[model samples]
Target: MWGTTFNRSRSEQTTVPCHECGAQLKIQRSCHEVFMRCESCDRIYDIADYVAEMDDAMERFMEGVYCDRV
Candidate 1:
């Protein structure tokens, strides 16, 4: 039988400061895809890319939404 496993890391718990609004960005959920929510900007970020740069940028940009507060 084939099975799927789910794992989480410390970064998943990382509430980074929003680059726009300065609010904390939190990890909402992770599965086949990862979802992050910015409370300050009220934006939902979905990270489906496996590439390193794109993934990092998406996370950073989403976090920035909170930082910029827009």
Candidate 2:
């Protein structure tokens, strides 16, 4: 029952792989919003501009960053 709600079918989930290293992202919470980080390359990213959808489990959030180090 929990699986059906939290873990949707793999194909249906919107997973965002790391753009640089192709690593899975972990969710980190901020006072205003949430963000993603890649452990392998230490690349940080912002999945969405707003945090309104952060609580939804079914929606897979992609990681993104605001500044580019270059």
Candidate 3:
């Protein structure tokens, strides 16, 4: 059930630089959200990329921790 409306009342938010406009964009945090739009340039960005990046970082951190414990 995909919808076009987004609730702006959520307090969970983060600021990230827009890829297209280079302006600070407010991103709402949600597990179901797959995409976000920049308010400045109206450019859309895939949220999966950010998630993948965080996953990769966590993997590396865990690997480092395991290596240190060995």
Candidate 4:
């Protein structure tokens, strides 16, 4: 009932706010790229831009990324 894990990516509903719309952003991925998306305004952002906002959710998601790598 929470975040769904896929083969190529992972995501979590995050407390991080979007830079443009000020809405909560979701940490998402496509293939190997990890980024954040704002559902309210349809905006995409590079994950590095929100490094200061990292928390448990982000930490867990990133760990999965590393596990999938060779």
Candidate 5:
């Protein structure tokens, strides 16, 4: 029987700025990941915050809540 496992080791790596030190970090995961640890600053960044904010804004828009644009 052939079985496959969910392996993150083969995920693509990306370089992103560290929220703490502003250094580049190699993120070994997908773009939809909620959080990642910065290799340079050793700090955890909440990437999902932006996604959550967008979701909230979408919900508000669906409810007919509009914000004034400058």
Candidate 6:
């Protein structure tokens, strides 16, 4: 995460489109792992399953990964 200084607006967030409810899925990272979570339906998903659907948010999220290495 980018700590408390950075925050993304709804339009800037990643949207994977949940299979069950058709809601947008959010990309989340925890303890060195990244995954997809659907807030609307309360479901967790493997990020690998939707790599191809990644968009701008994915790029920004991954950027944070290497930034945290410092």
Worst lDDT 10-window in candidate 4: 1-10
> For model 6, how does the per-residue alpha-carbon lDDT over 22-64 read when each residue is reduced to its tens digit?
8988877765566778889998888777778888887677655
Worst 10 residues of 1 by lDDT: 1-10
The CA lDDT of each predicted structure is 0.45, 0.45, 0.44, 0.76, 0.39, 0.68
Worst 10 residues of 2 by lDDT: 61-70
Query: On residues 12-56, what C-alpha lDDT tens digit does candidate 4 reach at each position?
Result: 888888999899988887665788889999988888899789877
Candidate 2 ranges with C-alpha deviation above 4 Å: 1-15, 49-70
Positional deviation of residue 14's Cα in model 5 after best superposition, in angstroms: 1.8
lDDT of 2 at 42: 88
- Candidate with the greatest TM-score versus the true structure: 4
Query: Model 3, which residues run further than 4 Å from truth?
Result: 1-13, 28-32, 51-70
Q: Model 4 lDDT vs. the true structure?
A: 0.76
- Give one digit per residue, the lDDT tens place, for model 3 in 1-70: 3223433332223445667787754444343443445678977666544443333323332232322221
- How do the predictions measure up, each by TM-score? 0.37, 0.44, 0.41, 0.74, 0.38, 0.68
Sorted by lDDT, highest first, which candidate order results? 4, 6, 2, 1, 3, 5
lDDT of 5 by residue, 4-67 (tens): 3322241223344555687754423333333445666677655443233333322322232112
Give per-residue lDDT, candidate 4, residue 28.
83
lDDT of 5: 0.39
Error of 1 at 70 (Å): 25
Quick one: ranking by TM-score, best first?
4, 6, 2, 3, 5, 1
lDDT per residue as tens, model 2, 1-70 = 5444342222222234567877655555454544666677987667463244343431442222223311
Q: Over 4 Å off in model 1, which ranges? A: 1-13, 46-70
Model 2, position 45: C-alpha lDDT score = 68
Q: After superposition, how far is residue 17 of candidate 2 from its true place, in Å?
A: 1.1
